[model samples]
Target: MPSESPCSGHADVEGKVGPESSGGPPTTLHSAPQNSPAMAQLLPSDVKMLLLMSRDPGRYSTVTRRLWGHIFDSLVVGSLERMALGVSQLMRPQALGPVIRATAMLYFHLCPRCTVQHYEAALDTFWRPPVKPPTLVFYSYDDPLCDTAHLQELLASWQQAGMPVWAQAWETSRHAAHLRQHPLEYRHALITFLGRLGLVAPTARL
Candidate 1:
């Protein structure tokens, strides 16, 4: 998990993304790619392994950013009166969802500049020199939060850059919930990757 502030932490089970192992070369597991470049810089010299799950590489491409901007604009527009009306009706169970959504949109509306800065940072991070660590990526084509095509493109770019990269794609799974949703498969993939990295014993089993 990343921190509420994207720049504050790396993606990990805790507030950061990478978890370090003890008494050996540190192994880092990164669940989010937005902070990968920062994590790369923070990694110990001996840390040479990474695991990327459902990476969001900062919407690096222009088309993606523009598309998302258009979508955001479409969803976040309405009169203040309408917003107040929506909020006033939130006492009704049926209006709760819309009110909650409205609140989120209002937040975004107030933080447009911050959002753009973060997006720019993410793009810059994505294009930074590739970390030398061998990487394993986990993604799903049907994940609603991560576009399959973008992830595929990222994977191809890493490979083309001569970074040792491996990827596993599933037909269906929730974003960042692959371990919970497909425990057996997730365990197998993780164990296999770790084994190859010599992080786990060959006989290791989940």
Candidate 2:
């Protein structure tokens, strides 16, 4: 339950392998069975926590990593209003600083361990070449928590491995705040990318 950064794009619940992403509109699916075998393997609890954290890092107490993990378990299963509060609080600097600091510490330390073992094990094996469903990676050069160079390296590796991926980089935008800073562009890019993949309806804007 360590405080996590805005990179909720990757879900590491229990450090277990879950599902492989696919180019399908999630809303259109009625159940897990419609997804690929790998996608269907995703843990419901983990996915819930991931979605919450991704949409809003403020959803849980990010001052401590362990507390964040617990929050992920509890709040994710909590009511909808609680989720809304989390996103709303993100605009308050006083409430966000501690969480951001904690997240930085977590990533600084976790990166090394993950690089030596996880990079070779999980990402390389589980998500092999020609990544299924394709991928759209969003990043910003101004993101404080993430290193652009390192992220580029990862993306390079993915592309070199023949994984199907599309990357978008912004000149300036806070970590995970792209959606807020440039709502129109963000939504357009997302819709366009997914639409191209046939995952989104032609008229969809979100």
Candidate 3:
């Protein structure tokens, strides 16, 4: 994975389209759902990765993406820790780099239901600039591991109260499995969404 200047807010992860962005494969755009009031009727914009994790145990089995990721992380972390001893130490110095990288990956692999410390910042959060991630599509089921209902309520509040809307979701779908179960509909939905921003070919699948 390629990295970018922290100041840019985007780490160049399979570029989806954005401001001052360059060099990379197309990543999935995280933006307004088809019926989002903001993206649908208000000012529309495409953006980098959407931050929400999708739940639906179905995805763990059907979505090769996450399974492969879990594999890769395990291999990487195991590799690193395996060779890190003292003299002939178990982990090699170079291995440490991969381990460190894997450690940071935690921020992304979180389950759909989560909470964070309430932000009470007055000014500079990151002195450079705040990369406001567009509203994300957080799909979940009644998974005991996450707070699905809470996320739903939060999304509803944002959409109804009408936040500038990172992007509003139109009748939301649940998690990554939505893709596996409804491939065509999922494709159509994503294509339709990104098409509005001119990122995808008009007649192509998303």
Find the candidate with the highest TM-score and give its number: 1
77-115, model 1: which lDDT tens digit per residue?
123333334333433465475665566456546764433
Query: What lDDT does candidate 1 reach at residue 10?
Result: 35
Candidate 2 overall lDDT versus native? 0.40
Q: Distance from true position, residue 103, model 3, in Å?
A: 20
lDDT tens digits by residue: candidate 3, 25-111: 434433222221111111112222321011122212222121110000000011112212111222246557555444423421341
Local distance difference test values of all predictions, in order: 0.43, 0.40, 0.29
TM-score of each: 0.54, 0.44, 0.32
Regions of candidate 2 where Cα sits further than 4 Å from its true position: 1-131
Q: Deviation in angstroms for 206 in model 2?
A: 2.5
Candidate 2: clashing pairs of residues: 1-65, 1-69, 2-65, 3-65
Off by over 4 Å in 1: 1-24, 32-106
